[model samples]
Target: MKTELVQTFGSRFERSLIEEIADIGTWMEVPAGETLMDIGNYIRQIPLLISGVIKVLREDEDSDELLLYYLEQGETCSVTMSCCLGQSKSEIRAVTETDATIVMVPVQKMEEWMAKYKGWRSYILESYHHRLNELLHTVDNIAFKNLDERLMEYLKKKSEISEDNNIRNTHQEIAVDLHTSRVVVSRLLKRLEKMKKLQLHRNYIQILDL
Candidate 1:
């Protein structure tokens, strides 16, 4: 648990808070494709992801799991402050991508720890601020930038496979990130492919001819 927490959040804190949380934390082992939470569920506890990745999804009124963001090991599940402070329920879903171990700290227990331990308090506060900044960056990117520029930047930053004239990113994943329809992305890809700027293949995209 200590190693997982340290690996995810970084090891700048002393051992006391980690030890304390470990004492009360309940271990949850979840299987792949499991939906941990649905929209309108009040997640009173926070899951500290110890292993594997969870997709954080949101749905439209039509109830589709439109992928919002993903949380992997070391990230906390659910942006609960919106639900915690305002709405009674969260419009979010957490789906497991692999067998995972999550340490669930009950809200009351977390509050108690925060009050009693300065280190824990500091960590939570810092984590919240960091998440807030990330949210702001996303908001700015979506609101201020053109889609093409945003797409390019997102690909450059998030694409795992990149070479001088090629990048590999999944179309479905890019559409989710771009908050656009897959058809739109497909059209754009075709245009780029026609220009000899990229090539879209099964499960992968390649940049071509620079």
Candidate 2:
């Protein structure tokens, strides 16, 4: 894990900072479908992803969740940083989309690193910018785009993150992410199938073209 961290961030950080992270971080492996963080919960540690993908979701008052963005290889969760900095309960949730390995940095260490390491501060700032832009794009999609367009965009994003156009997700799951009824999702999916944009199977979607 130490070696991996060095290889992953050595170019961006000083050797001393990298060594400190390796010494203080705890390694964890999370299984797919596991929830890493939950709403209203206080977090003591933040994860630096080593492998696989994590899905960040924002929940509403009614407990409905919207898929926000993904944390892929070599990425950190911006929401986790926010919570750690403010010492506040989490407002969003993070779930492992695939079997993943992460380095858990204690909140104390995170705060220390932010103050002591230039690279750490830059990484956090960059993460915030990237995720904020993604969330804004999500908001734009929801506020201005039609459901079909949103569905297509969602499929494309899932495909990109998974590195496979063969998406192993059910219509119901997609509907939940899009905040719509399963029946409506099924209907639109059928239309997409008829249009030859994709092929729908029992529990998966195969992108034939786009």
Candidate 3:
């Protein structure tokens, strides 16, 4: 655990802080497709990613999910941080995009570390800044971009984050993340395939152009 913590956060976090995390934080290994967090769940801990990726999403009025952002190694969920500090329920959902390892930091220690560890404080603030920018980008994508363009961006992000151009995600899964229907996703995917932008398999997509 110490080694993983150091490998993930060594450069930015103080050694003492890293040691503290290794000692106190609960180590967890989650498989792909696992829901690490869900909307309305109590937020008592914030996860520090050690490996793999987590996609965060927000639910709409009809309970459809819209992708917010992806959290990668060494990064924590800013929304989780806010909810933890406020002692409120989680507003967004976090799911593992692939097999993942993480350290769960108890929210009870947040205040102590904020006052005691400059690195921790900076990390929290910086996470907020970064996630805020991502939220704005999501807003712009929704407001200004066409569905096809948004779909391409979504595929690009999935490919890049998982480092696999041959994405094994189902059309219905993609539709859920994009806040659309399976029929719409299937139609758009076939259109993209006709344009030679991608290859649509029985259950997966292979990126050919974009």
Candidate 4:
């Protein structure tokens, strides 16, 4: 667990800080294709991803839609400030894309830590900053980026996690992330595959080139 925390947050802290959190929380495993959070759910808890990935999604009023974004290890599902400040009920839907393990921390326990641990406060502040930056980036991209560029950028980020360039993601998922139609994503992916830039297997994709 200490090793996982270091991998996520970097080794700027002594091991004791991570050990403190690990001591309290038991690991929970979530199977793929299960919904971890639904619309209008309480936000009094956050899960620390330890393995595999989860997809954060929200659907339109029609309910025949999805907004998919990959939430990998180390990313918290609950946006802490929103929940802490008593904002709207969380609209985000958290669904596991792969079998996953997460350490769930209740809000009350988090508050206690925030009050007691000076170093932990710094960690939370850093997390807030990073999350804010990411949100800003998402906003900027949606306003200015084209679908192709967004898809390419997503692939690039995914490639970093998977050294072999394997991006085991679906076109429908990519469509949601890019805010485009699945047909468009499918067409583009087919072109890329034909160019020999990637290998497409059942429910998985691997980038052979850039």
Q: How would you encode candidate 3's per-residue C-alpha lDDT over 22-121 as one tens digit per residue? A: 8889999999889999999998888999999999999988888999999999999989988888888999999999899999989998899999999999
lDDT score, residue 7, model 3?
A: 84
Candidate topping TM-score = 3
Pairs clashing within candidate 3: none
Error at 102, model 3, angstroms: 0.7
Q: Summarize candidate 4's per-residue lDDT along 124-180 as a digit string, tens digits.
A: 777677766776777677779876666767776768755558787778877766667
Clashes of each: 3, 0, 0, 0
lDDT of 1: 0.67
Per-residue C-alpha lDDT of model 1 across residues 1-210, encoded as one tens digit per residue: 667666655564457767756777787899877988778888677777788767666677755444445566666743764465454787777888567789887766666766787766676787677667766766788789977666666555434222234444467757865778778887777877787766777766765443
- What's the true lDDT of residue 33 in model 4? 76
lDDT of 4: 0.70
Q: What's the best-to-worst order under TM-score?
A: 3, 2, 4, 1
* Root-mean-square deviation of candidate 3: 1.1
Q: Which has the better TM-score: candidate 2, or candidate 4?
A: 2
How does each model score on lDDT?
A: 0.67, 0.88, 0.91, 0.70
What is the Cα-based lDDT of residue 141 in candidate 2?
Answer: 93
Q: Which stretches in model 4 have alpha-carbon errors above 4 Å?
A: 1-20, 64-69, 78-81, 193-203
Query: Alpha carbon lDDT of residue 111, candidate 4?
Result: 68
lDDT of 3: 0.91
- Evaluated against the true structure, the overall lDDT of model 2 is 0.88
Using Cα atoms with residue i matched to residue i, what is each candidate's TM-score against the true structure? 0.73, 0.96, 0.96, 0.77
Name the candidate that leads on lDDT.
Answer: 3
